[model samples]
Target: MHFHNNGNLFPLYLDIRYSFNAQSLVPFFAGAGGIMLDFSELDDTRIFINPSAGIRYVAANRTAMTFSTGLMVITGGPNARKSFINFKLGMELKRKSL
Candidate 1:
């Protein structure tokens, strides 16, 4: 899944993620980002035009985890780029939802 200042980039996402088939599984990682091609309004569900990136992991039918990293260019707020890098680790039974 992807989102930007305009709205959700992709409503649904699916991928052939890789994983380690073991008692303690290894997850698959994925990431994506790009610059805005046009301008738009901002709201509660909108993110301003800025450099953005995100990472996600999925364990073989067991667990799924996701995290986002990015920089926000605020208007006269702070002449700084809001950056973040996070991670998520969780367990899944029948299906993954983390």
Candidate 2:
């Protein structure tokens, strides 16, 4: 994850995820803005609260793909009021191995 300010000072955040099996996954979320969480395999719920961009790569069963997402927070600055939400999705291959 990465964030940039008015002076182009980019602060980065990182998170590591590990899968134990097909039904169990654990993630250690971390960031530069003092954000952290330990997510378990309970209904596949993950949360992030930061103003930055991040990329996640998942590889399994000899296949790999990437997922990306971004976060933003709008503060009442002297310039204007900005509030928006964005989502992205990408697929590498779609087939059945039989």
Candidate 3:
């Protein structure tokens, strides 16, 4: 967390991955994809790669949760050479079965 609020960046990603034992209670995943970085400041606009690995869990109700940790190598744009080690948590709501 930073005290400065001037830095605003939005990294839009597909969050795609290959899952192992997809139907199991605990599934492992790993993949990397191109990401688009959106920043108001000047400089480069190039696709960045964030390789990640994590586990996902699905409940009986079809709701799911995820935990991930990865190094996001974002070296473009202002304050150039930008990279971060991040931990992420995500959720997927239950949807109607097809």
Candidate 4:
């Protein structure tokens, strides 16, 4: 799960992983869509959708390096619709498989 914020906009997402055993690599696709709750005003709430794809490389031990990119879209609220692209580089850890 991940959370991102920009001013009054808050975006949340979940990531699922899949592995290709033959190559010892993982390829993943995820959706970033969730309900936005704005305490300041109910009318300001919006729904968001973001989609992304990426690949992971296991370097050593239980650690891996990841690179991914995605697009973010939001709808609802008075002229509040917006869109953008996001790129990220990160690392993750997993139990070493026997």
Arrange candidates, best TM-score first.
Answer: 4, 3, 1, 2
Q: lDDT per model, in order?
A: 0.37, 0.36, 0.64, 0.70
Best by lDDT: 4
TM-score of every candidate relative to the true structure:
0.29, 0.28, 0.68, 0.70
Clashes of each: 0, 0, 0, 0
Residue 89, model 3: lDDT of: 93
- Candidate 2 lDDT trough over 10 residues, lowest sum: 36-45
Question: Best-fitting candidate, measured by TM-score?
Answer: 4
Candidate 3 residue spans exceeding 4 A from truth: 1-7, 10-12, 35-46
Candidate 3, residues 32-72, lDDT tens digits: the string is 54644445543444456677778888865778888988886
Question: Local error of candidate 2 at 43, Å?
Answer: 41
Candidate 1 residue lDDT tens string, 35-81: 32222322222223334334445555656554444444322112234
In terms of TM-score, which candidate is stronger, 1 or 4?
Answer: 4
Which window of ten consecutive residues has the lowest lDDT sum in model 4?
1-10
Q: What is the Cα-based lDDT of residue 22 in candidate 1?
A: 36
Per-candidate Cα RMSD to the true structure, in Å, reads 8.6, 13.5, 3.7, 3.8
Judged by lDDT relative to the true structure, which candidate is superior, 1 or 2? 1
Ranking by lDDT: 4, 3, 1, 2
- Give model 1's TM-score versus the native structure: 0.29
User: What stretches of model 1 exceed 4 Å from their correct place?
Assistant: 1-17, 20-24, 32-44, 47-81, 95-98
